[model samples]
Target: MKKDIQIPEVSNVYVSVVNEYNDIYKTHDWNAYIINDKDVALEMVLIVTRGFSEIKSTSTMRHKLDMLPAKSYAKIEFMQEDVLALNNEFKVTFFEANKMFEKTYLFRKNTINKKALQTIPLMEVRGVLVK
Candidate 1:
């Protein structure tokens, strides 16, 4: 016999798994929002996407060091506000699935194009998916 687990309804939520390096793994984009004056940080509706690689996290933190063997996948939820915040603060956001985040760094106001948003690549990402 096989067990049937019901995946939560996340039509309006965006989810991305981050590794120990803070890289983004698999990500799902949805039409979600954060209600005003809500105790809950944000309400996310999970959206469905095809051809997404499902990965897991395989890293640990001990004392002040993080031992990460390789890049894996995990489930993560990102609110709309979080996305806006990342865009505003960091100027560049990661849209790749199952990529190590450690190799990516966000520069606030440091780049050749200081007027526009710039991203410094520490590592090559597998790919980036939007929507």
Candidate 2:
């Protein structure tokens, strides 16, 4: 019976971290975003995120969106400077066409930095992308 269960593959959805400038604070900060590149809208979008290291772990954060329109993106959260030292993980789950799909995107410790910036899909700025 275990073999009979089929898990759907996730595609066209991505988690990206972009370094953005805060005009009000005159500072640069990193922010996480969820990109939905599918042709159809996703329903009941949910994302659980956290950062961890061998010696310590951050608290889990949960975010939900009733719908994520096709070919769009949403900001998940702001990343503090300290969290960059830890492995960051984002678990995304949503439904499309009555089928459930889930995917985990991870940025390994110290992987998110200026040198890794690149043009990301659906977002105008350059940032680090985890597939």
Candidate 3:
């Protein structure tokens, strides 16, 4: 008779946003809890929002953290702005340790009372088994 093996659940995941120019604005570790899982696969998403302005030039560009993975493939998209804009949006997708994950956002489309930028800093990571 063969025995059935159970895979442990993946949890305790988070995300953060880093500004390469300003270290002070960088977050070491932000809270982005996992809310969904399926068939030994875990999925998560996060967002970071902010605002900025520039003088001297009418055209402005914002850099966003798109896709970043330690050992997997990823895809990222910015739906709302072109190369020139004071504000922007971001969307990211990636696979970690063989599992899939994704994130998305839209920025600079609402009143000043709302957030201007969004980011996803972390993805749940796992180890692959070798035969």
Candidate 4:
């Protein structure tokens, strides 16, 4: 069995999230864009956690990129209701650098009274892991 690992931080990679709503069409849109701003190519594994109350859910994505071509973005989109959890977590690993990053956000605390459509940069991380 492999032991669970904890990694150190590697900066420059970013996760940008935007929320969109359509009142007339009754649609909810949540977009997550992972940006790699480094000069080297990256292999990444991403995980996101969402839920409310006792129930929880997770979504994962993995990709091998050609350096993200410098300042380009790869995006994933999901419905807003899917992330109803007050506390949301994002984990990303850069295979090329052998670094891992984790971040958690409290939706109710941060966006309770904010506009429905908003963009936030998840810069500060909760934990980091390295090989």
The TM-score leader among the candidates is 2
Of 2 and 4, the candidate ranking higher by lDDT: 2
Global lDDT of each candidate = 0.22, 0.95, 0.30, 0.47
For candidate 3, write residues 68-117 as lDDT tens digits.
33323232222222222333333333344555544543333222111323
Could you tally the backbone clashes for each prediction?
15, 0, 5, 7
Candidate 3 stretches greater than 4 Å from native = 1-87, 110-131
Clash count, predicted structure 3: 5
Candidate 1 stretches with Cα past 4 Å from truth are: 1-71, 85-102, 107-131
Order the candidates by lDDT, highest first — what do you get? 2, 4, 3, 1
Candidate 4: tens digits of C-alpha lDDT, residues 44-96: 54445444444554554343434444455566445364454343444555565
Query: Candidate 4, after superposition: displacement of residue 119 in Å?
Result: 7.1
lDDT of 4: 0.47
> Is 2 or 3 the stronger prediction by TM-score?
2
Shift of residue 106 alpha carbon in model 3, Å: 1.9
Give the per-residue lDDT of model 1 (tens digit) for 10-128.
Answer: 22122222112223644433221111121222212122222111232212211111221123222222323233322211111121232212111121211212133222122222212
TM-score of each: 0.17, 0.96, 0.24, 0.51
Candidate 2 residue-wise lDDT, 1-27, digit = tens = 999877699999999999999999999
lDDT of 2: 0.95
Candidate 2 has a TM-score of 0.96
